[model samples]
Target chain A: MTEGFDRIVAAVAGMEEAARSFSDECRIVFLRNITIEGIDTLLTRNLYAERIRPIVQFGGYGTMVQDVLAADGAAGSDADLIVLALSVDELDASYGSPGWTSHAASAQLEGLFELLASRTRATIAVHSFIGPLWSEQGLIVAAEDRDLTSQTAALNRLVVEAVRRHSPRFVLMDWERYLRRLGAESALDPRGHYLWRAPFKRAFLEVWAQQLARVVCALRGRAKKVLVLDCDNTLWGGVIGEDGLDGIQLDRHQYPGRAFFDFQTTIRQLAARGVLIALCSKNNEAEALDVIDHHPACQLRRADLAAWRINWNDKASNLSALAAELNLGLDSFVFVDDSALECELIRQLLPQVTVMQVPRKLHELPPLLLRDGLFDTLSVTGEDSRRTRLYQDQRQREQLRSAVHSIEDYLRSLETVARIHRADNGEVPRIAQLTQKTNQFNLTTRRYSEQDIRAFIADEDVEVFSLTARDRFDSLGLVGVLVVFIEGTEARVDSFLLSCRALGRRLELAMIARCLAKLREQRGIEISRAEYLPTARNAQVADFWPSVGFSVTGTADGGTRYMRLIDGHAGGTPTFVTIEDD
Target chain B: MTTPAIEGRFFRILSSLLQVPLEQLGHDTSRKSCQAWDSLKHMHLVLALEEEFGIEFDDAEIADLNSAAALLDAVSRKVSA
Candidate 1:
């Protein structure tokens, strides 16, 4: 084996003991037509970074349908995720024949997905079939007759459409991408395929397992949310202070400057996709700002950044300050810098952040940045694309804050309006995103998936309420979510959270009052109980329940439970804010 | 490569793939002696050895590779030739 593959195998071999020590387990079951041995170790190595241990099992081979059907019974129902590692060659031998049809195969696959969706709560990731390595009818005949190549393409399209029916829970694992990355000729192991049922070589299996682990990590809300960048030599070609604005190389047509320009363009695209970009540079603030604003080749302007620190302060402290300003944990950050010293300092001091040192070869910068799957997400919501705008709007609110005299004056002048309504099908994705990403102002700190929220919306004993806040400045779309479970006139708040952007507006109190009123009027819930489960990052909300007029009923190790009796006038909406039903 | 170097590389790859200690995997280690060396693990060992030594073993030769000594001899012969 090559040295790289040898190192990977060595690393995976050492993960067997480490994988067993994780407290939380992500169980996965693979149902395939081929043998895939030693995959569990590879998956464990990939997921070890997230502190989630994976327990992998193989359902019987060539029994993909039967395995899923049996999972609804008591045997395989405990799986947290299911992977369908199937190939078209094993499924249909007559695929490229004269009159071969896809009707029966498509119907069977559809039925299998339906059974999985209805009977199981596990997340399903099915591999898309990579087309055959060679056409059976040769090049010209295959192209003319629309043989295996075209037929497989059509079947893949069908799989994509089918998976879209149950998105965010059922995802398509694009095996074709892996095949392209590793050429098709070397990816297939003919000896292994003939000796055993396994079709892929060891090298292909290693990378494929890592890709699958990336999808699993993204689904579990472990994807990084922020990208912190360095300015000197990282964003542009030279130091802004020494080289000056006109002297620095940042052109679109030149050699070294062109590479930096392309890198900045990629960073801009990342910002547009909802990654909050921040600049941490040791240069003078005025010089860097002038260069960013006036340079013709600067693709990332000052407005593109959500936050920046262009001072001489140490970057570890600056990153902490940025986290405080953005109201995020240090774990959600991916910091990139060109200086080896700065990257190493951040790696040692702020070990929570993923740090990347810019490669010495300038041309390799952009592609290397995109491959790590650090920012992978299953579905990007509208709120994500509008994230930079939301931060900018927060800055506007802060400006308004400084102009006003008192807190009450600021609230009254802003004229904040909060709309509380029962969540519908369209709001499921945003609600799930909030539960996964919000940490600072969350009362219970319970994370949920879109599938879990949908289940709650359909249950008669549970209610999911979403809050959207708007004022004179801008609209924060779907900023809050409250989920309550009711049992015999007693309502239990399962989750109560507001996005960090909506925290200082006294909207949480408004949401609680409206929730109590609605539960009393619609669901006949008389007494409401809520809990404050303190996490490392959510200590700011320790007294949130009492602040919202819920008296403490019980207390455990650092966790407080509060209960409130529903009267008509208790904890009314704040005087400055208006509450309405949407 | 010399005979000692080839043997060292073979044992290292074998020990890693089988999850056994290098000292524990000597000439006596075989499919029957080690419980982890099942049919599935045997296939993994063959694949790893083939890729490491840049050699291919036919079906009959793979079946004869039952012990560490036999596997090292096969790799040494192939690597020297």
Candidate 2:
């Protein structure tokens, strides 16, 4: 989203006051073996636009490895991320000249990776070496293994292999792929290199900053999660009401029909990886459902969507209803429609939702959606693959609730069980994700990354627990996370949040009681402290701590603090819910 | 004097990139006159000028293209050549 070098510079210059408005701050350290003075300005400008305050530190030129080694005892130890940007020429010199054999160069690179792994605790991102555009070996460079090009390939392989060993913490930027995409001639300016010791062109830096900004956004859990689609010409060639199931042009054999088929296939794939799909169509409900149910060429079915609003109502109201039914914030939704009027209406009514205007030509739709990077994610978990099924099960439970007369009988007959366990390494990503995404029921909304969660688990005084709920319908996966900091005879709850799907069942009370019982058994804690910080969406939990027998201690900075004695108050677990500990 | 068309568009880009008032930039405007025109911004100005005029500058030309007058002269020469 960064425009150009000059625009980015102007944005960075005005960021001193703009940065104070952001809630999250990320510390990034840059270590390059070349002159990289321009990168900081570019990165800062883009990051500030995303509500991320970047505290950047640049090491001296040509001292990447040395600075990483010195970071163990220096101020860089506190950095959340460390980026190593090394040019291929500098790497060759560091590995004892380009004349060294491929095997020897690979061995030296492996040692450097090992040193870097042992020396730094922050997440590491290293740039893969870009091969020189002009190889003196000419056509021989394509034939049997040459020196410079082959050495670059070997080094890139070593970098990728190193990342595999230290997965989820070490990542390679793949500058070789970036260079190929940008064309090597435009990416590297020989004149800039010789004049100012800057190896990359200014234009290349503009794109580089944009790519890194996406990575940073994904790491911070700001990726969009829901895709709200329109039905008429947006999904198929014609309106479902006019073109019936058999008349719509969605087949794979035609011109525009094939494009619609491919777009539907793309949307189906995104659903498979936990992106919630919803439909908002201004048409007869029976007609739309018939097309989705009976169309042979349709890749998406009614079951694929978590919810839908198929009526003659305006799209803005339908979208609002869909967000409420799914228990997701509007900010997490991306709306795609082929109608310019509809897109403009939603943009004005709900400014938080990301609106993507589909191009008039059907063939241009898929590429435009794919290139936006709206649904980018760094990693996927098993829970993501089972999201649609969980929502379907939730609908079944709602039906069962209406049939029963009493609330207690409905809960007891469903046979709900709460499984509580200490969060381990495998569950760190989900825990961090819940902390970032859960807004309605979150107390003291503090977002953490997987790296931050790992640090908490490694500490001696902190305790992290994850909760899972299952009933007659299906397993809800890890839906709750609670973090506590213990000191001698007292403990403070750092964060407590539950997924919206897991709420309204008294699961919060059960989870907290289990945590208290464990703390009393392990640390003999007497009291617990909790706080409720209200946000625009988290007003639902403003009085949650008080409802659980925690008395108000004080109020500060628009947040209420509460404390409760835990000497004999550990048995607050509700009777209808069964507890299973792992 | 240069053509009003060329000067009008050139000052618009300068004002937007530098985040300064249009009245503040003139032919004599240089790094010393504009608070935003530091060495880093100077490089960005060169890139913007190259993109606006569709001309590539050599290292010597880029290094010398500091003031508003120098940029206009170089771009005019490249446009008329």
Candidate 3:
């Protein structure tokens, strides 16, 4: 079954199961001023299937503001997420009236958002107001005098402003855009709404639930990070081996070539957003490299890819090798191939990796890639935008390493500098992303959300440190994170993770030593406690703590615990590396 | 009366939507006979039937379509028309 179909079935089954039982995974409270009963089953079911147990608590009808106020005052609110499902009509009481203006509506929305921001620490998702299609004012509504369309557009803009004002905590679910995509008539059943007070049709609810599930997954740090592409007809119109470099259809001017150009452009955009792109093509290595390097129409270059497997081998084995080279799991990869047989082979061999078959028609390929929303994320962090450059820098560093005689000499020659600082507001997202994506070099494979990282920063007992590395090549932005929970004269490390791209340069050791030196300056830190949590992908860092002079304390919960004395451990920053504290 | 070919295809669609065996669903079978024929499933049945037969039902026809016989009759009239 297709992933979408499987999710739908799981959602349907989850809805049926949720009606009979409660979810333990997530507690989501829905505060809406409209009838949104139709969405409960669909949302709960999809989230449940994703292992996010959803327990929905609905506010009384048309009492969203009042319900939020109550939730704010209530002690120990257990909700992890609060969904504000607001409608345009609810925002503007004069919605259908002839005297409608967006002035009051905008003010009211801003006030509501302000109240929501102040009252709740839970992740808030506010649904953007979608205006009704059939207006009583009719075609005259388009006129400036009776302009409901312009007024509604202004209200939507106000919602975006509010989201910006309360960012990382508040997210806007663009229901207006969603309705436009699904078509208003199909999304809303007026008869059903009037008969049973159902605001959305069942079909609309199903799709909305799926979209919401993706958003939730993104929030929970479970988004796929890699896109493994096949290069034959997948990237271009014809095979590079059969069709000469000039004959390949990848130009922006021609018919099929334009389609391929558009596809490559989309792939580049995804790469810019930190989706690691790798090539698994069955072609002559030199020929493929020549096409990528010299092609005028090629948007993706060798620098854009983290790894490539261009050889006459099975794609499944190539994908495994790519995963190993990149130090990422098979689960984090999405395989896109034009051949159905190749797609099937990888799907069977590497069941964990998501496999997508390229469309038969060249024109359909771009839309097919964009439609699934597989790489949907809540917010784009600095790390995301800088990922392509970082990978390119790593490739350059690899080349530098190959030419040097010894590892120590190469490290010294690079003049690598480590800048260690207490993670500030701007660095929280990158820190959270590192905790989520950095599996190989992570001491403890504990995935944390941006919200969780923010909480850690706010807590007086917790200290979160982020380390950024700069060699002769490039500045590796926020490559390592160390979160410690401080107590009286003793600190326990909650998380210690470094990005794999910055591994093997002794940066992990530098990070630890600098963190320890800084802790020693505090005068009260006598000992540092750390743990090594073994996950399927984090085996590389199992002996990391012991290597760094942390004595083995004990074993518990499928992990080994360690403690190191901080007061007497005399360690200056490594002779080769320089540390800048901020 | 519907032809045997149309009836057979109609039964198959109904069976798929209702999740019931074709042998169990007859012309006389109604919402009362099938436990899964709740309001939600009923709406889904209407949508599925409309798409399967390439016909649209009015609000009145939809409300009255509570049984297999009624659905078949409504579909037959719409298809014939």
What is each predicted model's overall lDDT from 0 to 1? 0.82, 0.80, 0.78
- Candidate 3 steric clashes: 1
Write model 2 residue lDDT over A1-582, tens digit each, in one string. Answer: 335555555667767797987988878888776766677788788788778988888876766667767735222567777777776555555433435445655665677677767776777777788776667565664444546778678777888888888876787777776677788777887766776667887667766777667667778987888999998888888986677666788989998898889999889888887898888989866567666766789889978988778888999999998888888899899999888999999999999999998897677876665565678676667898788778777866775755543455446545579999889999999999999999998998899999999999999899999998997456988999999999889999999999999987889999999999899888898999999989999988988988888999999889999999986767668788999987
Q: Please list the residue runs of candidate 1 whose C-alpha ends up more than 4 Å from where it truly belongs after superposition.
A: A1-18, A71-75, A98-101, A139-145, A397-582, B1-5, B20-29, B32-34
Best by TM-score: 1
DockQ of 1: 0.18
Question: Interface Cα RMSD per model, in Å?
Answer: 2.6, 2.8, 5.9
- Model 2 lDDT tens row, B1-81: 357877887787788677788988899999777888877567667767777767777777787888999888887777777
In candidate 3, how many Å is residue A387 off? Answer: 2.1
For model 3, state the Cα shift of residue A166 in Å. 2.4
Native-referenced Cα lDDT, model 2: 0.80
When sorted by DockQ, best at the front, the candidate numbers are 2, 1, 3
Tens-place lDDT per residue, model 3, B1-81, is 588877987887677556677789898889988996787667666755676677888876687788999999998888888
Pull out the clashing pairs in model 1: A1-B51, A1-B52
Question: What TM-score would candidate 2 get against the native?
Answer: 0.63
Worst 10 residues of 1 chain A by lDDT: A1-10
Candidate 1, A417-516: lDDT as tens digits: 9999999999999999999999999988888999999999999999999999897557988999999999899999999999998988899889999989
